[model samples]
Target: GGLVHYVTWPGSSRLLVSDPAALKHILLTNQRNFPRPRQQMSLLRKVVGANSLLATEGDTHRAARQRLNPHFRFANVSLVFPIFVETAHRLVDRWSKLIDADAAGGGAAIIDVHPELSHFTLDVIGLSGFGYDFDALASAGNPVTDAVNSLLTPLSLFVLLRSAIPALNALPLASLRKEKEARATVRGTVAKIVRKRMEQASEPVEK
Candidate 1:
């Protein structure tokens, strides 16, 4: 119905229009012409991967989506149901222990469930998607979990600075330094896993 202009950075205008026709035209018809901002894509690539769908465009984006769509289908997802249930049970067991520990220490102890849930979700992703047990909920200070947390942490002020002045990313801030370290850790861990998988695959099948 109306156009809204937001000044995300100095001397720049980001538009948000409430017109359905305009939205449809931009999102559906002219999407290729209006790709994600280069800075946003570059930042996302560092977190996800160089070949990540979030950072890809045009034919590469289409090909990646097409390849991933089958594995993400409801039917395919159903195949991981057992893994999901097992993870869920593991989460419950961990929580039960926490509650028991609290009860033994005091009558009623306040607990923060956010980190527990975060670890549970990460464990689920590791087991189901990568066939690696992160065991984040079962153990504290898991390197993979710590790496992911460091990389994906939301820095509100840093985000605004990065978005407004893309060059700020080059500055060696504490958050940026931590992110670099986390990325290295993730790369090393994934490389090790990939090498192991390759070695296993090359082994002769047990007859």
Candidate 2:
């Protein structure tokens, strides 16, 4: 088997695995030995947590998966069908209203659905999965949405350079400072939601 190399810089070369069997062997059969590159993980850990399931590997990843398996089983998912249907009906209602308003204006109405779809996705996750109302669909300019979107703003030259040379992230650059603030806001918002849910859980249920 021959190797495939991608030249990134004058002295840097990144290897690419072209063979499917080799890819699977490295990624699945022997995953622990083929952990994500440090640079990629570092960027991701800033958005998610250091111990977040997506960022974890090896024993930590296996343990996290084991702990989370039950709630994702088919039997458990079937129980949440009603929540999914309710969220879907709300989405239809919102779009219907938009269409109706546009019809009243007497022009072929053009609607951009991408942002609304993102809101719907977030709202579904909040209501169906977490029993919380993010209100991302009902509210315009949600802070959480803004914070998460800002986190993924197309990589600027500054970001690309900093990613290539991680030491640059340590410097006080304006974009880097903004990225930190955005991540903090997302983390803080999620913590508040989790604390509220825990408090609700502790309350005694009424008959």
Candidate 3:
């Protein structure tokens, strides 16, 4: 079979598309003909919100892209490169502190860099995307950090099953309730930050 082929299971099948040209055609050139699957959209919409660019389709997605295009242009994106550099330096400093503390205790430094890297990523996103400082590396326990952690934490087996079988989502699960609360927190925090930015933009500049 070619790069594009179908994989079949007992009750369902999926088209596996790997060719770059075909991917472009499906995702950009002729996207309208290849709508995302309802289940895929439902899963994504839970995390990104229904109106987000990743969740929307057709005209809504196009309009959102148009609105965001200017800010994403290479020239504009380059302006945030310094933010990445600064955040990376902070990560290094944090690691150094950990190593020094370990040495002081006569113990080898055995740091798990995974959570540190995740915190670095969140800090970068907060600074570059929202002009807000999460300071995730310096501390923890903030509302935004807590909410994001809740959302990104590993899913329980029941939740995973629910995601794979949408019918299972209807069952009352405490994990699902926590997920709903986390989503609300994330959306509310983002809306508050965006509103603050808009207010600042509208204020008159002092000479």
Candidate 4:
């Protein structure tokens, strides 16, 4: 909504807009006239290797947004609040027990509560955000969420590498093998949950 200057990477060329309305006119009102600047899209395309919502342009983005909007809507979120409350309470209770254990043993316990909090948040968000229960706060995280979290460190590197030396990843190698294995673990876990839900949905309703 304000003036913006576009700077070229290897060269020196400046593009500018002075009027606020004109800036909006180009960026939002008529965006197709200027696609994602090469600098940003190039990095995105290199990373995910698919035109996901963040990377999608024009009509594809509009369509995807329309489809996914309901999942993020307020009304849909209301249905999952009980799950969120229960999971949060369970997390508090678990932490209380850990503290209790340390007190009883007369020794200070060193524990990173970060992972515990993360799993709780994931369970809550999964249920509320997507109408799916990840149950990541259980004895252990639900398989799908656990696998995904386990792979996050490696996946972050994968994204970084893709953005940095994308073409080199095309070769079959040890790194690729580890990436594939991690991806497979995540996929299998998610597929199991989806299949179970589908089977349940297909069952005949009792009168």
TM-score each candidate. Answer: 0.73, 0.74, 0.76, 0.58
For model 1, the superposed segments whose C-alpha errors exceed 4 Å read 1-40, 73-75, 103-114, 163-166
Number of the top lDDT candidate: 3
Model 4 has a clash total of: 0
Superior by TM-score: candidate 1 or candidate 3: 3
Candidate models: Cα lDDT each = 0.81, 0.81, 0.85, 0.69
Q: lDDT per residue, candidate 1, 1-207, as tens digits?
A: 468888864578899878998988776678798887876787788877889777798889888989999999999899789988998899888778878988998867566777767788888777787788988888778888899877666657667568668788799788778888899988888788778878988999988
Candidate 3, residues 111-175, lDDT tens digits: the string is 88877787899899899998999888998587777777776666566655666798886767787
Q: By TM-score, how accurate is candidate 1? A: 0.73
Quality of model 4 by C-alpha lDDT: 0.69
Q: How does candidate 2 score on lDDT?
A: 0.81
How are the candidates ranked when ordered by TM-score, highest leading? 3, 2, 1, 4
Candidate with more favorable, higher TM-score: 1 or 2? 2
